[model samples]
Target: MSLEVLLDTNTCIFILNHRPPQVAERFAEHPIGSIGVSSITAAELSFGMHKSGSEKNLERLKHFLTPLAVLPFDDEAARVYGRVRAELQARGTPIGPLDTLIGAHALALGATLVTNNTREFKRISGLALEDWL
Candidate 1:
């Protein structure tokens, strides 16, 4: 499965908020259909929505996710995640589980990961990354 990009939760949040023109502009450069997100990101956004307890934010998140492809943590992604997690653990540099999952999803789909947290995502071997923020 070919994908142009996989947006991280932070990038999606930035797009939803429309703050920091630079970040927003970077997101805008890609066509909506070409942009993708991991199911993990969807869950993360949903969690934020639930925590906020704001119907308005929930609506905004729904609208934002409508056009983008939400990739699942399928078998391939799971395998990638296991390898990545093991490698990081072996190196004594472990990132968040969600971040590792997101990286695995991107790797499985051959999509460049757009994130602001390059410092963490960079630890995943063979995962292409870009800092849109």
Candidate 2:
């Protein structure tokens, strides 16, 4: 169950929209099953789809998610989240809750996080990160 990379919500959206060539190329480098998403990302995408109220977008999102593995925020991830959140808070640099969860999940799996929001994701120590965009 070795996961090579975890796609962030932003990356997923970019892939779906096909607006950025670099991101698409980066994503193409990885095998379909090797790429994954946090359950948090799935939820976030679903939220955005619901908010947009566009059936076409919903179908596109569904098709986009079909091939990628979705990682869960299990107990180990929760523990990591607690430590990460506390450390960030002590440092007075709290990030978004969803980002924290994504970071924690990536850390637990030892997978690199792929996101354009490196500014915020980099705040978590020991979490590998890459920005395709």
Candidate 3:
């Protein structure tokens, strides 16, 4: 059975920059299904790309994500963010606010979250965390 890995923001960047073999290997491990990317990840990438002053790289990033399914910051996701945050706080998981939001989106979509930063996100009980670190 293949897993629908929701590419985390950091792993997404690493995969896009061609800097990590682990991310690619993970894809190969579960390629039969599809990949999911969050818009929050795109915002993070755009912010970083803008800081680097590389329009070409930004274009490349856009093209890279064009084929993946996008998990938008929709109302349902926002609602899940609140619930996920409450659950995490109650469970003593101190992930950063942004990561919480991203993980919540993955949870709402029922997709396994693929990331390098697992410690923070693993705190949320239902977040299927897969590390590519």
Candidate 4:
């Protein structure tokens, strides 16, 4: 299925934790296969699961990921990453490494990045962003 929105790590966490009701509400407004997350985001969630040392949370994450697409970080995304990273670094407004990857991934796929961290992702030109929180 083609992904229309690529959820960033923080957005996914918000959905998983069910903190702000609007995130889930907005997420529910989308068709199931139309939304997804980058593999980088999945890795970040998995890292949190391991760090928490909770099998229940790991299982919860697994269940939460069932209906969502997990797009890989392919060569095209890597190419975007190289260009975006260099541009941000040159401008002296570089974001975190993983955030760079996430933004580049969404740009490579031509998908809107659903993230609450707009201040950081906004540095990369041509990257579409939506804040769900």
lDDT of 4 by residue, 1-133 (tens): 5789999999999999897989989999999899999999999999999999999999999998999999999999999999999999999999999999999999999999999999999999999999987
Model 3 spans with C-alpha error above 4 angstroms = 1-3, 28-33
Model 2: per-residue lDDT, tens digit, 11-127? 998999886988988898998778999999999999999899999999998888888898788999999999999999999999999999999999998999999999999999999
- Which pairs of residues collide in model 3? none
Local distance difference test, each candidate: 0.90, 0.92, 0.81, 0.95
Q: Any runs in candidate 2 off by more than 4 Å, and if so which?
A: none
Worst ten-residue run, lDDT, model 2? 1-10
Q: lDDT tens digits, residues 1-133, model 1? A: 3469999999888888897778889877787678899999999999999899999999999998998898888999999888999999999999998998999889988999999999999999898998866
Instruction: Order candidates by lDDT, high to low.
Output: 4, 2, 1, 3
Residue 131 shift from truth in candidate 4, angstroms: 0.5
Candidate 1: residue 8 Cα off by (Å) = 0.5
* TM-scores for candidates 1 onward, in order: 0.95, 0.96, 0.87, 0.97
Weakest 10 consecutive residues of candidate 3 by summed lDDT: 24-33
Model 4 scores worst on lDDT over the 10 consecutive residues at: 1-10
Tell me how far candidate 1 lies from the true structure as C-alpha RMSD in angstroms.
Answer: 1.3
Question: Candidate 2 local accuracy as lDDT?
Answer: 0.92
